[model samples]
Target: MMSETNPYMMVGERLCMDFINTVSWRESADKRREWFTSYAKWVDWCIHAEVLTGQQAKALLLEAEEKPSEAGDVLKQAIEMREVMYRIFKSISKDISPHQPDLELFNASVSHFYQTLQIIHEKDHYTLKFKQTENNLGIMLPPILQSAVDLLISNNDLERVKQCEGDPCGWLFFDTSRNRSRRWCSMSDCGNRAKARRFYQKEK
Candidate 1:
């Protein structure tokens, strides 16, 4: 069930970017509400993001409940990975190199992700997919890792990546616009707020 006050915004064009954006406001010196407060919420976001099916989400939730401590540890790991990705991508957005520690952390996740890779026989072609097993937490990570890997390896894709111009809303996104002029996380949210602020300043 979705929370009445849930703030899981998905403004990023890419899955990994959206996941990094689970943190509400990035440029804010003070912290904001973290969307993935628990393993269940993370599962919910995965379901909302279409990363997991209803049945898969239900099973993961059941497993989490059975092993609460393990679930917490996984959640902590997820958040740590998320922050590392955020820093690395933010550096990329600025055309700067990511910190060594962040790059090492990302490589560790990538190494783990590659270990689960498998080929699936689809209707016409063999598609690559992660091997789903009893280690649900580990299984959940590869798709997100793949998204990051895909963006990092593509020069054009990396060039289109941007950080939102809205103050304190330092979310990253893939600028899918033809002109690559996307400057805000969302026109309805930060964009409008910025415009309103400009209007108020002009009047003053």
Candidate 2:
């Protein structure tokens, strides 16, 4: 189950987009904050994102506790993958091709994802999952990577993809508005701030 109050918001409509937004104030020159500071926090975000079940998260956390070094390495890899993804999608938003290196990095992650694919039966249905072999935390990347690949290849409205207009907020999202006029990440946060700033400027 997910928490009622999370410091992070799921402003991104796509799973991959939400995963990329784990960092706060991503476009800021300074004062940026990382939400996935540790392996446990990363697992928590994964649970909240529904990328991992509660049981899988618990098992992973237990394994991480026993193997801190491995866990740390996985965390680093996850961060690196997230950054590469952000660059690729940010390029897509601008109608520019992703850098060859970024594509290669993403393809590597995709390759790893398929290597560990597994079929499991649960609750009267069968689903594909990454086999949890030895508590390797990098296993988390495949599903997230697949989400990005799906978004890139799908016919879903790519024109609706947008980066928030909020200064220092570089979160990418699919604008699901009928008119495609959505702007800020959230109206209660950046939207309200922008409105207040406009009012203040008008009164000056």
Candidate 1, run of 10 with poorest lDDT: 1-10
- Writing each residue's lDDT as its tens digit, candidate 2 over 26-89 gives 9997968999899999999888788888998998898898889999999999999999999998
Candidate 1 global CA lDDT score:
0.86
Model 2 Cα shift for residue 98 (angstroms):
1.2
Error of 2 at 196 (Å): 1.4
* Model 2: lDDT to the true structure: 0.86
Give the distance in Å from residue 193's predicted Cα in candidate 2 to where it truly belongs. Answer: 1.5
Model 1 stretches astray by more than 4 angstroms: 1-7, 29-31
